[model samples]
Target: MWWDIVKVLYIATRWPWPVEMGRQRMIVQTLEFAATLGEVHLLSFGDPPTKPAPDFISSSGMLEMSGLMGIAGSMLRRPLLPLQSHLFLNGPATAAVMEAAERIRPDVIVFDMARLSHLALAIHRHYPGIRLVLDMDDRLSKRYQRMLTNETAGDLGGTFEARLPGAIRFLVPRLKKLLLRVEKSLMDRSERRAADVFDAILMVSALEADEMRTDCPGRADVVAFPPLINELPVPQQDFSRSVRFVFIGNAGYAPNAEALELLDRAAVQVSKNTGSSDTDYCFQAAGKPLAHAVYKKVEVAGFVPDLSAFLAGNAVLVAPILQGTGIKTKIIDALEHSVPVITTPVGAEGLGLTEGEHFICVLGEDDLAQACLHIIRSPEARGGLARMAAAARNKGLTSQNRTILRDRLTFAFGL
Candidate 1:
């Protein structure tokens, strides 16, 4: 008889398969890493009814105690659940994950985000010996607090719909601020308690790990584990195209939506300044919709089937994000495709890209327009930037990086 492989269960608050956004990228990467070790079991909630299945044997929250609990939790949590889902908690999702964990009795349990730490709490209560890992995607409580503070400080600007004058505009921000404060307090306590219970608290960036260390002090072990992107299956090259610029991301996101608006404005100014009426230069955007004026020069591709092909066809990728947290995976995907990039300083954060070397980094609107014009006008400069991006891609997302992550996981779990 064949001996059964040691089982590892991954609990996600959102659908992990059919990778859509940056968080999905993390889930897919984690699944790939876990597959290399043992039989990996997946349990998820909060996806649409018809979301595609994962490669592994999986269970959905369509008809089960966990599923019902998830639905109820979503209803009760209301607006909070959507934001909470990002951290992997949301009430119903966690309940389903807990039920799955108890049934599976896996040797190790990994919670993809802090919101899902509740499952770790539940697991420790029943199966104390099982290794527990909390993958802190970011310092979430701090981020929420930052948002609250920004809103209160009037630094959020009028662009945010939440700042508009209405019942929702007035009530929602106040409610969100109150809820975020309460959630932050509860989550901070939960993190400390879970840190004592779990084997490792894995953070996405060293800066995040440092913040956690400050919070817990000498109580728990924390490790920085940045996200990993799979190596490109194709060769890198600067695709020869007529200066087409691309920006790929979920346009529904406020930062990305704002960036697109800003880019459109900058593009118009650049066109007027250069006295070019012809649509020789195009700005192609991919992903979900946003509230912005569309122009003949702008093409909204809306969620391309193949991102690599889209990037390869464009001359440069532009990211003019003014706000947000976490590493920008769009930048990584662009670099992976060896596409030259023009971005704001905020867009290039955590990637360790050198200014004017790996990509062009600009600060103001005028600078941004000028940078775009310069890149579009100079083929030699674009080529050089593309070469640098390709090199950065290899250094950032190689087989070696994956191996290092595998080893780190092994050590963290004592596998």
Candidate 2:
């Protein structure tokens, strides 16, 4: 603690009301930890909360700056300006943010997500002395670029099954690629700009921080904002007795939706290939409802009220996330709960947890199905994975993890 108290005015691109997704979790956790230092106020680009906010939020307001025309104009102007700038630096939002800042007049201003990076810079211009921090959470530019490339490869040589729809799909991919290219370029520029402007740039992992520096050069004061588990759930004693494997995440998001689809298809394949009926094993996915339908055997346990209890009770967590950037908070949550996880390397990135040590990492659907079967069949393997996860959580991501973030902030602001 550098001072008796330090007031922070936090701004976010989206309202993290329910705190269901990874970014929301990060924002909430960061605010909760920051409250330990001093009072925190919030301004977000969404409808204001219907009810009172948490105690940590000294005050809050909405930045309803985007309308249909503004969004379309932003898209149209993306090639001319940074996408984030056009989206967030519009007249209304900027005025609202600056006005809020003027009223709050805090020691520090924290912006959540790259969309708000421009807002942070604008705030700094008005209040030069206030320390600025940008919580990027993920390298979104890289994510969009990767997705564009993947889509191009997947759809470039497509056959016209339904001629009109197929042609439309083909054109859509190219259009998306063009748009993504603009976004990537804009995002890169914005990252560098944020690096130069903000006092600190926060990433979810060290790897992501290093990557950001490649473009940002000397000015990128990137800090790793790894998750903190306040308490690790008591490890489930037996695995053989447990019958269900669970996957937890917001399925409305594309990456998690694809993962759920993969799980569903894999479960179907496992049934046919292994001569085991759906009754042999159960896969329960708990989170937001999937955008697409899943196999009957793969149950959607939408929005589990008590995630801790659900995670503690589940035998294994199947996180077959094939695409996405940043660390999957669900995986970390599972680990903190001592639930063995099966995931791909992409899902396990930045965690530094070794394959077959903290949890099993498998490639593709077949390998995933086999891994699940192995866990179901062998309690010893499940227990072993659970023990390793518990050890890793205790060693790295416990309640004490908050100190790391607080220290980083202290250093950033010269507190």
Candidate 3:
């Protein structure tokens, strides 16, 4: 049978709308690709994020998201399972999945992230003939370890916080450091389990994919895929439109929150180091505002509706991420808009970007301040970095690279 004849079932932990995080963007991008190959049946948790469900989705169903109490009870009942798995896949979710599979009669089942790997396993157990594809996204275990090493694990806030029990919510801020220690172990175990079961595992980061191949129980091949980017920003010629240094990310995310703090201090350092007035050094943030995050220098722009325009007006993206894993999508967003970036080595990881060419990699607030001064004072440097980064980004996001992932998905569906 032709690849287009293959029906694909995607069990999304959440609808990839209100896309505040990179993982959510991953879900939408993967699903869009799946839709291009064939009909995609989506069974997502909670309500549809947007109205007039996307045209790529052939059909859709909403599964009830587990409440905090129910998830806690599930964790209590199933001690062996990762606590996060209760919040993701459970007995009811498995049942719902089976019912959807029966109706769709899909040949392939696809899901993203380690938390939903339990669903992949459950579906495979029930229907051994259906091939499973895991879009594992990032190496969460490594990210957790990075946070632990940097002592920023407590910043692990997410959209789910609002739903957490009052006591747990109150305690989580203080307890996150300990919970991350436990979660790192769980995520490692989950990655191994998924690697052992799934037929195809897709990772956005080539570096992480290689690491996974070395460490995990590999029954199936683990492939690294370039991040899917369908939206191309209008090309900009000018790199010195303004002196603004921007950071784009969701504050609900831990690494973003961590970066926000670093940027706040970096902004102040730049002012003091260069004796630059507000006109010479403007630090701006665009995305979900971090609550109670007192920033002495950076101005929170909240979610900018026109990111392309905003990035065009701002000359540089300063993402001094403390620690985390996975390709920084915001850097990609910045480059696409022809905006140069100044980020930590951690922020630049897995993107195959080069320092002093594609982006300026800095280590601390002092270095960040120096980089800002260098860029703002040198128009040649600003223009050169943005041009090089834009060219590099185009090469990275080429269809040739995406075709590897597309072929992998098709082969898995046929299997």
lDDT of 3 by residue, 134-164 (tens): 8888888898788788865445446666655
lDDT for every model? 0.65, 0.72, 0.76
User: What does the lDDT read for residue 44 in candidate 3?
Assistant: 84
Q: Report RMSD for candidate 2.
A: 5.3
Worst 10 residues of 2 by lDDT: 155-164
Candidate 1 backbone clash number = 3
Candidate 2 per-residue lDDT over residues 1-415, each given as its tens digit: 3555788888876676778688888888778777877888988866566655697789888886555467567667655455444445568888988888778778888888776776776776778888888888888777776677664222221121122233344564556667567767777777777778887887887789888878677564788777775565475545545556778887767777778878887777666655533224678889888555646568888988987778765457889887778888988787667666788998888887777767688888888888776665666765576576676566556323667778876665547
- Give me the displacement of residue 180 in model 1, in angstroms: 4.8
For candidate 3, the clash count comes to 0
Root-mean-square deviation (CA) per prediction: 5.5, 5.3, 2.5
* Candidate 2 TM-score to native: 0.87
Instruction: Report the lDDT tens digits of candidate 1 across residue range 1-415.
Output: 0266767887765666566677777777777677777777876654363556566644434312233344345546644432343234345555666677677768878877776665676678877888888777777666556566544322222223332325434554457657667666665666666567678877766666777787776444687666766666644454344567788887655567667877887888777775543235678888866656575456888878877777664457888876665667788777666667788877776666677667788775688789777666666655576576666676566432777888877666657
lDDT (Cα) of model 1: 0.65
Q: TM-scores across all candidates?
A: 0.79, 0.87, 0.91
| Each model's backbone clash number | 3, 0, 0
Q: Please report the candidate that would top lDDT against the real structure.
A: 3
